[model samples]
Target: MYLEKLAEGKTEIGESGLPPRPPENFDMTKFDRGRKFIQDHVICHVLAMFISLVCGMSVVNLLEPLIFTNNSDTPNKAYRRYISTFMHVTKWYYGNIWEENNKAQTSILTVRNMHNKVRKDMTAHEAKIKNSESVDIDSLNHERIASCPMAMKDVRLSQYDMSLVQTGFLGIVVMYPRFVGIDCTEAELDDFVYFWYGVGYMLGITDKNNICKEGFHITRDICKEIEQQILIPSLENPPSQFYPMAKAFIDGGNIAHKNKLNSVESVLAIGYHGMNVKLPKLSFMDYCRYLFLRGFVIVIYYCPPVKKLFNKIIRHFFWDSSVLEKKMN
Candidate 1:
């Protein structure tokens, strides 16, 4: 029925009949003129891209001084600055490309959390073994506790601490004042700090046991011996130097006690658990481009002469060129 209605309006036309004409006032020239206008201003598209790049860098350059000033009264201001700077830099650099980076961050946190758990469990098992048997494992006198299974687990958990040391070293190297530059904004600087810390956390670099060899080989027997000999003495009068780092180590050890891995399979299980986690891998080329543009903005901002020169050049090239004609004498 629908097809029949459509067919009813159809008419057979003779070749001699005048073809249907477009509206009398319709001007094809208008469409052509519009196309020509766009073709003539192709440089505008390129200029827009340049402007965006410059703006993004400018934001980064402006962030550091604004956030990390000497008067900034926030506690742990340096740490906070690192976190904030990382987020801002990442957002600016990646913007719409943040999903993968976020996923990677989640995975790293998961691994860290699990690593903490295994350490705790191991600590408890070591305590029970030492208290029940009184085997006096410390008297055996081996520099490395390779034979003790609990000690081996402790050693393995120590890998996380080693990871943290590696990350901290890398952070110090990459985030140096000379390396990232003084012109970067507080936000950008914070971003730089956060990026490395986040990467370290994800890579299992912040684990405590792995940082020191003696700490790594801690077993049920060894810990008991240490508590009686070293820790008790320290409690009476803690060393002034290395106190903070030592405290951090003790705290990390406590966390590890809850996360013991008894068997080889358990060890493998913890390692493999976060394997499915994903991370964003931003292109190095894009990051380099971002840095270059940021540097360019900083140069313009810091040097008034360069800014004036840029303005003059832009005026001559674009504004002057866009004028229909020169002023008459």
Candidate 2:
């Protein structure tokens, strides 16, 4: 029931006739608390971004037709594209979402506009092909068509896919809090879920298809199921595109941040630790680095002073500039 309902979201777009509601409908007090929860956990949030990217690349449903488009298909450009994308996400988390003219509201609306544009572009591409007398769809190689984004000629970006993308942000934190260093009360976690719920609503996710619609516990379960059924399987037997996309994501992030450690070993270390999955064997030094990162993450979570220091560095390095701001201006 959970997965099916979510799958139905692929056909849904727009506001679904629902007003934008923050936390008031569920728990009025959680609104501000929800905002603060995100504000206070910068490092964990960054880790969640890494996990989200890994999960996203693995999901073929999202990649082949939509994500596999020119924007992210190539390594050289994928990182810049994603960095710009997540910078907008960071704006929504940092800005006051409930305020009418706030960055959060503006950013979400902007993303909706971008999505609509992609749909139009894809549809137009398909139309041209269909009208071409030289082309014969029936005679085309099925594999070739399947590998191309042009195959999505008449398809619309469904609500189902958007919600899955939402899970990329929320699921890892909820399901593997320790991996991401999410140290908080049940109430705080609930607040965090509601926080994303509001963001999802503003992003034009229909109320019925909202991943956080059912609140924290149920939504966490839904995220877990996705990880088990879809995400994990895809990772285990990833398609050809996953390597280039995932490598590009890691490489781009490292280069943008001036991070020195983006080796295959580093990526493998994170995959093993964050997702609790067995991967190819690592060298002695690689294993040591993994242990160091794992231990460092634990220290950041348990030691308030250390966590505070890291959060400051994270904000300065990753959040100081907004890519969306540059684009909008």
Candidate 3:
């Protein structure tokens, strides 16, 4: 009947040479309907799979710290670990911030402006000093001595005091303008770097401050003192690479000094600041997640059993409780 219908031209023949029409009252749209149904089902299945993968990965990421521990026997490993972790977290946060707001070009401009302002102030101060006569200098020195009323007391400047002064001066030149209204010129910027390097040596990381204390072995106070006194000063007058601003001060006869400065500069510039510059931006939620993950890891990896038990209770009540509740009910 379908062939006859096709031959009589009452119904159109499909490519398969059968009548295109279904029986009267039949649902002719079933094939289209079935295809639509399958497509929707497949899409839903794919979406479910993707969601499952993401959820699984999140769980794995959360649990990763439990699976690894540092095996190094270095003194103050915990402190080192904390510093390393903080650096990592900071970098992640910094990068993410920039990624989210690509046009946020504030840091560089702020730093440059700060440099310019400090330079201008320094120039003015130098001019004032140069114009002062011998009488004026004597009078100024007398005033300075008079101001130090406690000179006869037990008032030797602490390492901290010196560090504060150095850092403060550098901050005025390099950092103040970024946060405040100061501007630094190229010379001031160089001076800032030189001061910081000196400060770094005083902090005890450099050769000059590497001596061990007499009795106590490497206490936090001792380390801090070393850092403030030794490491900071050693870092001062760094090479051009460490502080590009230092290049302006180098003379031909000061090859050894230049080399030492370069070495220190390379370490600080290429190492410390380099790491600082690469910090990532992170959303608050993401940061919280990272902190939670880190805390979880530290608890598992480093905490004593008793502390771990306490932490577990805290974790259950404070951190993980909501997550578990949501999963269950």
Candidate 4:
């Protein structure tokens, strides 16, 4: 049936399984460019730094399955998992982030399908372990240690937690527009949210979590509820097992500095929401350093001279940044 519909020239499929007509005069060519050469050039650093230092690291909190006792003391595993994820997402995201055309849309779908496969495999593994005729603790421990089993041991991520991740993306859509210089228009925001809403569905969330209808306000309310109800309680009394994973993220050689920045930012972000999480402690001076890096990143990304120079650099050795961006899509 799906293949047959494609034979009929249907390009748009909505959640309701109906095809929506394309908007009139929507220029497919310009959307394919992602950002003009200069725009993609300027925002690269902003997007990268945001993912590396803040949003990337905070995803650990969303790994609610780590709260389970059977999966204690596996920060090394979590570190391995999240760091790999960070690298994949950063490269994939910035590589194709600016395009509004269909060609690049499959990237998210591919990632989502990968996520679904992993979830199904893990859930099956957990079920096998639980229904086993006997237990093998040592063997299980070895596998868990070797493979980073914090979130995979005897359970899967809860449906509610998965739902919360949808809200998290919506939060980004809401807040990104408020960036001082970036003109994230309503149409842009809607595209961003719509993309993630598909992601949410693939991740096993329900329509109730799809607050794109209620606007950012209600979307944020769901985010707040996730924090107050699940996030805060888990963090304040965080499981001992998850700390090593957090440590690996914070101390991992490749991304330690960014991890430290993430840790501190997590503290501030949580507090800003009138909530608290007992994040890994850092000294006052450490706090200053991360804050400074965050601010400095924004400054450099917005500086036109820097952007122009970087654009030249990319065109010099690599392909044109704009060409690469579109090609990635």
Residues 1-329, candidate 1: write the lDDT tens digits: 22222222223110111222222443334423322322232222122222222111112111112221321222244223333333322222222111345533343444446445544554454555556555655433221222222242322234423332232222221222222123334333333334333333333442222121112122222323322443334333432222232223223323444532122222112112212112223355434444454465457546656655665544343334423112210
Off by over 4 Å in 3: 1-104, 134-329
User: Which 10-residue span in candidate 2 carries the lowest summed lDDT?
Assistant: 137-146
| Model 2, runs deviating above 4 Å | 14-28, 65-68, 74-76, 135-145, 148-154, 257-260, 283-289, 317-329
RMSD for all candidates, in order, please.
30.1, 3.8, 33.1, 9.5
**Residue 121 Cα positional deviation in candidate 3, in Å, after optimal superposition:** 1.4
**Which ranges in model 1 have alpha carbons more than 4 Å from their true place?**
1-106, 134-170, 174-187, 196-329
Model 4, span 167-255: residue lDDT tens: 55345334533332244456554444454443444334444434443444555555555556555555555544445545544455335
lDDT of 2 at 88: 76
| Backbone clash count for every predicted candidate, in the order shown | 36, 4, 57, 4
TM-score of each: 0.22, 0.84, 0.18, 0.55
**C-alpha lDDT score of every prediction, in listed order:** 0.31, 0.70, 0.28, 0.42
Better of 1 and 2 by lDDT: 2
Candidate 4 regions with alpha-carbon error over 4 angstroms? 1-61, 64-106, 137-159, 170-191, 198-206, 211-213, 253-281, 297-329
Q: Compared with the true structure, what per-residue lDDT tens digits does model 2 show for residues 67-152?
A: 42566655447676776676777777677656778876777778877876766665565675567685565343334335633355
How does candidate 1 score on lDDT? 0.31
Which candidate leads the pack in lDDT?
2
User: What would the per-residue lDDT of candidate 3 be over residues 197-286, giving only the tens digit for each residue?
Assistant: 322232322212212211112222343343344334334422222222122222111352343222212223321221133323555554
Number of residue pairs clashing in candidate 4, backbone atoms closer than 3 angstroms, sequence gap of 3 or more or interchain: 4
Tell me the deviation in Å of residue 221 in model 4. 2.2
Q: Distance from true position, residue 248, model 3, in Å?
A: 33
